[model samples]
Each structure stands twice: as C-alpha cells, then as structure tokens.
Target: MNDTTWTTPDLTGHRVLVPGGTGAVGEGVVRAFLEAGAEVIVPTRSEERSAEFRTMLGHAADEHLHLVVHDYTSFAGAQDLVEQIVHFRGGLDSVVAPIGGWWQGSTLAEITEQDWHSAFTVLGTTHMAVLRAALPYLTDAGAYTVIVGDSSAWPVPGSGLVSMEQAALLMMQRVAAAETGSSRRVFSLVLGPVTTRHAEGFVEAKDVGTVTVAISAGPVPSASIGLHDHGEVQTALSLLTAGEAR
Candidate 1:
C-alpha cells in the first residue's frame, strides 16, 4: 500500500444515483462522487433527513447533489425514482449502492420471523429492487457497484442475519455481472469494519468512497474486490488508477 491518497477522477456531466446516501458510509460515497464532478442524486423518504444530509455535506451539496424525498424501498418506488432521474437529468451514467443495516440477535435457528423479515428480507429486497429498476436504463458503458461487508464471507455469531443478507448481496452482484457480460460493469466491494463518522476501524469511509469512485471511472480486472483495511484500499485504488491511465 502507498502512503499517498488516490486522486479523484473527473466525472463532470455524469449522472449517478446513490439510494442510501443518508447513512454514514453512504455519506462518504456521496461526497466523493460529488467531488468528482458527477451529478449525484440521493433518495430519502424524509425531507428532514434530506435537510440533515445537505447540512452534513455543507457547500458540497450545492451544485451537483440532488436530494429527492422519495421512498425507494419497493420495486415500484425504485422504478419511479429512476424514471424521474432520467427525465430530469436526461440520463444516468452510474450507480453506487451502499444500502445495508446491522442486526444482532439469537442464532439463526432461534431467530424470530420478524427479525428475519427485517434483517434479511427487507435489506436484500431493497438492493434487488434498485438493481432491477436501474439496470435497463444504465448506460452501456456505465457501472453498477454494490457495497457489502466482510461478514458475507466470515460468520458473525450474533449478527448471523447480517452475514446471510450480505452474502446474498455478493451473489446478486456476481450474477448481475455475468448476465450483463460486456454491456455494462457490475462490481461488488466487500468491506470489513469500516471507520465512519461515528466509529473507528481499519478502513475509512472516505477510502471506501474513493475506491468506489475509481471503479465508476473505468473498468476493473474483476467484479469482486475486498477492502478489508487501509492497505487493501490503497492497493485497489492504485490498480484502478493504473487502469485509468491506460
């Protein structure tokens, strides 16, 4: 890993959608994309949440950030959101979905129906809904990236549902990549404990955003990349930056 940070790619005039941009990790992703000069649209169900996010972003939210107060948890709502974006922005160039949640509960065998529905079903469905709704409209050369946790590969005892749901999302990205072939790019970013604005960890949220923006800028060798720590994040960014230079 290098000691320096990767430079943000120039994404002026590009239109990108980030569905869960109100969350901590998503905030970094949103900021990085906006800094890269992309017209980033973030959807939220609450206007108050939108206001809060804008405040969090400060002046960065002024020009290119589009905060839409809309619910994108369901298929119909996701489709509508995409339609509205296309109609307004003329077209969408890319998408970065960092949508997820944590759930701590009993073992899988002892988990309740409500817990399963909330942790596994709802989170997984939201990702699928956004993918299905946005895939058709995504530019042929554009990218669709999914952000998941390392729990997908490593079992978390109390958060078994988070692990299961994250694994499912990883598989979904693989399938989508295979189905799309060379028409479009699909990437899965598997992260470990991330350092967000609220917590400390090996991988920082800004680094996550940087790698994600790099992926959107150009093609990568593989669809799945692991960002477990600072070293891994730097390696990925270096590889991506090198690819862009070519």
Candidate 2:
C-alpha cells in the first residue's frame, strides 16, 4: 500500500464520459480528465443535477464539459444515453462509471427486502446495463472503468450487502476484461475510504481522480487495481506513459 497520491494522465484531445459526475468521487474523476485536456460528457438524472455539477466545477465547467439529462439504471436507458452522446459528439474515447451507494448497520439476516432490492437492482444491475450499453460504442482502443469501494475486499459486519454488490461489480469488470481480447479494456479502481463531503476518511477526492485518470489513459496490465497498491499502478502508468513519449 502506498501513501503517495497517483498522478494524472495527459488526456489531450481525448473524449471521455463520466456517468455521475456531480457526486464527490465522480467530481474528482471529472476534474482530473478536464485538467488533462479531455472533453468530458457527463450525464445527470435531471437539469438540477447538471446545474449542480456546473456549480461544483465552478470556472472549469465551460465548453469542454457537456452535460446531458439521462438515466443510467436500465439497459435501454443507458443505450439511449450513449446514443445521445454519440449523436452529439461523434463518440467517446473512454467511459468511467462511479455510480454506486453504500449503506451499513444491518446484518444479512436482519436486512430488509427493500435493502436487497436496492442493492442488487441499483448497484448490480445498473453496472451491467452500463457495460452492455457501452460495448457498441467502446470498440477497439476504448476503455471502460468502474470505481469500486473497499467493502469488496474488506467486508464489514453490518455492511455485508455492500460487500456483496461491490464484489459482484469487481468480478463484472474482470469478466469483461477476460472476454474483451485486445480491442477494448475493462478495469476497476478498488478504493479505500475516500475523503468526500458525503463520507469521512483518508483518501482525498482529487487523489482518487488522479488514479482514475491514470488507469483510464491506458497500459494497465490487468482488469482490477487497488488504489492503495501504488507500486503496481505507478509502474504500469510510468511504463505506458514512457512508451507514449517514445
């Protein structure tokens, strides 16, 4: 595990889409890409959310940031959302989904039906939908990344449901990577406790974004990466960036 923060990638001229760019973690990822010179397309659930994201970005939310009102929960919805982006901007070079929620304080036996429904329906199914819908547009050379929480590895007692959904998403990306061949890549950024207004922790949102941007830019050796595993991430990014330079 490394204590140092990951560096951002040079995404000059790249076109990227972040599904939930208004949220804390999502905002960091979006900012990193924007600073890296990528034109980012963000999809929000409503005009209000789009405006909120714009306010969040402040001065950086100009020209390069394109916000669309869309839902990503259903396969059909994700498909339509992607179609809209493609129609408007031609296509995307990368797509990153930070769309997930966490809840604790209940054992599996004590978990309610609504809890189970929300966990699987939103966290599990929505990720699958994103993957299915992005495939058509994310052909050769494109990258798809999903941000995963620490509960996937370090399962908590009251957060069993969170662990379950996170684990599922982790495997989802791994499977996508294995089946993808060399055309496109599927990756996961396994995160620890992040420092967000929504949650209290160690990892900073900007640091999280740096890692996300680094991986999304390319040359990752495997499908899933631990944010705390600095050696691996840095080595891969260094090698890849160096190769690009030469």
Candidate 3:
C-alpha cells in the first residue's frame, strides 16, 4: 500500500458492531472495518448462515472479524448482542445498524397494519434497539450510524411508509447528533435504491430482480451506493477511529 494518508482507514483499534452485517452491503462494511484494523462483530439470528458468511469472506475471515447469532427484533435482543460483544472483546466502539427491510413501492392508501409493523421493525425499531443497547458503551469517543436511504431525503411516488420511517430515522439521528454534538458522532448512511438480492422481503418478489436493476441504472434518478464504495465507509471509519491516533 502507498504511504498515503487516506489509504488506510482511521479505525486502528476500535471494535465495531454491525447489525444485519452479513448482507451484501453490510458485509462490505464489515470488510472495510477489518481492513482498517478494527475488530468487526456481526450479529444476527441466523446460525449456519453466520458461518457461511465467514466462508464467503474468502481469506480475511480471521479471529478479528467474528459473527454472533442473536435476534435483533427487540430491546432485550439488542442488549444480548451488546453483552456478547463485551464478553468477546470488551465494549463497542461504534455500531453500523443496517436492518433494511419492507421497502416495496406501496401507496399510502394501500399500506396495511402488517406493512407498517414490518417497516417499523426493520427501520425504526431496529435502530431503537441498537441505540438503546449501545448507550452504555457509546460516549464522547465513540459513534453510531444508522443506514438509511435517499428516499428519506426526498419524495417517491409510492413510498409513503418508507418515506415516513426514513424521515423519522433522519430526525432521530439528527437529534442524537445535536445532543451528542462534539461529544459523539451520530451519522446516517443515506443512499438511493440499491441493486441486490438483499431486498428479499422489501420488494415485490417477482418485480425485485428486474425492476431493482432498472431502478439502479435507469431514469429512476436514484443514486445507488454501496458500503465498500471507497468514499463513505472510509470516511466513516476515520471519524469513528480518529481517537485512536490521538
């Protein structure tokens, strides 16, 4: 590697917890953290799938990068994940919560109770749980990030529920950021629609495969960004770990 200031991320010794970290983009974030010499913990409910994720990481799946099987659906589950991280390698330095689900195109009139609950669980509730769990560990030195979508920033024709949750999350993050201010850095990963298989429950099953690509590439006017896209993740890592160098 070149001796450039930006080549290596700033997370030299931080411990990062990535909720729903095994998915495509989330995995990319995990890998980026690992590359930055940070200890990466992936927590999810899937057991065998967690191991499979390790295998999928090729050769970088070492002791520093680990996976934990835990439910992220409630407050208690989030606490359990935090405890597991503490048991393994101390406390959390930062958290990357990316529980993206229930993201299909549905008009406000068509949204149902079930849909609302699902979106809340994936978008709002997950962030709530993770933040509550991380409260004890996060301080003036650490930060947390909630992965969000560009729809949160702008309007979409048939994404009322999504827009609602997205807007709520942005507000929550901003509030936390304001409260934390220079003490802690609460950030948001705002991106446009992504083209990947991670949209299993979010998209209309049949329309997902085809339309997702179209949405990513065509005149949807949405920008598709990834965790390992080289810009955002690196900067995030730097911000989270700058204390290490100091």
Candidate 4:
C-alpha cells in the first residue's frame, strides 16, 4: 500500500467492459486495463457520473476508454450494454465487475426483511444480470471476473447478510466456470480491507488496480485469488502468471 508504483500487464488488442467503473475500486480496474493496452468500456448510470470518472482518470483517459450511460443491474440494461459493446468494441474479450457495496446492520437473527432484499437484489441480482448478458459476447478465451471481499470466505458477525450474499457470488463464479467450460474463465479476487472513497484501510486503490491488471491480462493460474493476508498482489500474480500452479 505504501508504494505507488507497480507494473502493468500487456493487454494489447484486448477489449474489456467494466460495469460500475466509476466507483473508487472500479476506477482502479479501469485504469489497469487502459494501462495494460486494452480497449476499455465503462458503464455509468448517468452522463454526470461518466464525466466524473473521466475527470478522475485525467491523462489516462484516451480513445481506448469509453464511458457509456447504461445501468448494468437489470437484465435489459445489461443486454443493452452488451449490444453497445458489441457494436462499439466489436465484442468483449473480458468483463470485470468490481460491483458491490458494503453495508452494516443487525446480526443475522435480527436482520430485517429490508436487509435481505437490499443485499440480495443489489449484490446478487446485478452480478447475475451482467454475467448472463455478457456470456454470449465473451471471446473463447475471455474471462468474467468479480471482485469480492473477505466476508465471503470467513464469518463476520454482524455482517451476515453481506457475507452470505458474497459467498453466494463466489459459488456463482464456480457455476459460471462450469457452464462456460474452458472456453471462458470465471474467477473472483478476495481482498482484505481496501481503501476507497467509501472506506479506507490496509489496501490501496492502486494495489487493486495492479492485481486486476495482472489477472485480467490472461491465463490466470487460479479461479480464486485470496489477498486477505494483504500480501503483495502483483508479486503473487507474477508467480501465478508464470505458470505456477495455484
């Protein structure tokens, strides 16, 4: 987290779509792809949000980066996004969804109906929509990667609802991998406390960016990369991408 410098992967000719690419962590993913020489398309709910994202990118914003106004949370919205990507980028080589929000409330037993609805509908449903809509357009060696948190791997007392849905998304990754076969890859990156505009702690946004770039660039060694220990993500990725078994 201290070092601001990291190596980016080579992704020339790669076309990527990042839904919700305006958020703190999502921006990292977007920057990584652009720096890695990939054509990146990001979707935002409004033109204002897209403009804000462009501002954040500063010099990194170029013709390779596109900001589209579309909500990827609904089936129709995701379909529209896929259509846009196909028509614009000529189809996608990969999709990385750093899409999810952190919420805290009562314990599992005390969790209200609203809690369940909000967590599942937002985190679960949106991921399902994005993956379902993008699968057909993914290249033979393309990938669908989701950024997740530690709650999915370990119990987090009052964060039961978030943990449960995250775990479900982990399983969903496995299911997608199975259904898609070896033609496409589905994976998840589990991180420790990540610093973002929403929250701040151990991991920096650039660290997320570095790890994302390495993984998305190609031939991931594993389906799940756990950074809960807060290790040097890029180093691990180097080892993995060098053909080391996970």
Assess every candidate by TM-score.
Answer: 0.95, 0.88, 0.74, 0.90
Best by TM-score: 1
For model 2, residues 155-244, the per-residue Cα lDDT tens digits are 799889889999998998888878876667777888877777688666667666766676667665445666554454465456545533
Give the range where candidate 1 is weakest over 10 consecutive residues by summed lDDT. 1-10
lDDT digits (tens) for residues 1-246 of candidate 3 = 111453443555677787867776576567666666677888766788887888888787877887877887688888887887777676677777666654775787887888878765466877888887885676343457677777776767776788788778878777776665555656665655444446432222212111211111122111222232334434433433342210
| Over 4 Å off, model 1 | 1-5, 244-246
Give the whole-model CA lDDT for all candidates, comma-separated. Answer: 0.87, 0.76, 0.61, 0.79
Which is the winner by TM-score between candidate 3 and candidate 4?
Answer: 4
Candidate 1, residue 66: lDDT: 90
Error of 3 at 140 (Å): 4.5
lDDT per residue for candidate 1 within 49-140, as digits (tens), equals 88888998898886889988998889998999999999989988889999987889999899999999999999999999999999889985
In model 1, residue pairs whose N, Cα or C atoms come closer than 3 Å (at least 3 residues apart or on different chains), thus clashing, are: none
Model 1 lDDT at residue 152: 95
Give the C-alpha miss distance for residue 34 in model 2, angstroms: 0.7
Give per-residue lDDT, candidate 3, residue 225: 25
